[model samples]
Target: MEPAGRFITFEGIDGAGKSSHIDTLAAAFRRLGETVTVTREPGGTPLAEKIRALLLNDAMDALTESLLVFAGRRDHLRCVIEPALARGEVVLCDRFTDATFAYQGGGRGFDAKVLSILERITQSGIALEPEKMRDPDLTIWFDLPPEMAAARLADARAPDRFESQPAEFFGRVRQGYAERASAAPQRFVRLDAGQPRDAVWSQLTGSLVQRGWLQAGTSDVGASAS
Candidate 1:
């Protein structure tokens, strides 16, 4: 199921500004003449969106929550991500399996081994092709302290189930993200989200340039032209 297109995922604790910059990055890619597919985890297709609603609002046990997310992921892969990537479009997803690991495994104290099993089942199914488990080519992890992230989200909106968790929970989630990045350093770029917005943007753009996703001087011009 791995496709020719690149998959990029954004990760962070809530309110780390991942959402703020996703579209901007996608626009940059489009400027480079890459077809971009913007999507999100626990939701993408119709069924997945409905599942997302439940995952966000409904109270569920940790195992139940993990299973639901994997179900939604399966539908998302089959309906949206795979096809777009097959067509050579860059897929910019808001989050993916990483969130499941962070939220369910790290935050909720669920068993990582159980998550691994479900991950394989949902990603590759019975066919058992390891390569079929689609992983992002690059992950931009916006690193922020849990308290600061909580402060930022204070007045944003009504907290969802995950967002309603305490700062200690978010701390665990942050650690989860950090561990994932450490385990996959080459595929991850960690940015300090606590910086000023402009500085953060600069780092993001710089990372892209370093990765050869953008030409140094042409980004602005190409973006404007597109």
Candidate 2:
């Protein structure tokens, strides 16, 4: 039987350069003869993508937003993430529950306890064990100052509801991510996003190598996977 696959997630506030590097990591896995499945939270399955649209465009209350995201997460897990992992294909997710905690719980002042409960329910099904919930084996958090992240977003595409929030809101979101990384240091690797693109890529690939996910001297064999 094939070995179980690794689930690696990329997370950070909007404009933190996560989207810029997720595919690079995936291509590295592919070059190593690993089947890579690149996907994202709030969307993966068709139904979940619809939910993603609603979540990004609508201005709903915090609880409502949380519920909607969890609902999408359920569909994503059942339809995409679980099956890919079962097949021993490396799953590279752009974002996951961490974003929900950062945005809704931290930025919107929603209750973390409540989010935790929902997390367990959505990822673990009927089980109440927090440990049973699906979590990334490794989460690459692109840590950047909120101001710099905002500046990056300024030149990017039109802002979504969350992206349109004030700088103070992003500050709280960054704090939320910091808390998560502190709480689960083993699963998270925080990288400075302010560095040059090549430096950021080095940090990412180096972390994967250190964790035994990649070989010591594998060269980039394909074009940019961005």
Residue 173 lDDT in candidate 1: 92
Off by over 4 Å in 1: 125-131, 218-226
lDDT by residue for model 1 over 44-124, one digit each (tens)?
899999999999998889999999999999999888887888888999999998888998989998998999889888888
Q: How high is the lDDT of residue 180 in model 2?
A: 94
lDDT of 2 by residue, 1-226 (tens): 3229898999999889988787777777887899999999879899999999999998789999999999999989888888888888999999999999999999999999999999888998422234577888999999999999999999889999989999999999999999999999999999999987777887888888898889876434222333
Per-model C-alpha lDDT, please? Answer: 0.86, 0.87
Give the clashing pairs for model 1.
Answer: none
Error of 1 at 222 (Å): 13
Runs in model 2 with CA error above 4 Å?
1-3, 125-131, 219-226
Instruction: Give candidate 1's root-mean-square deviation (CA, Å).
Output: 2.8
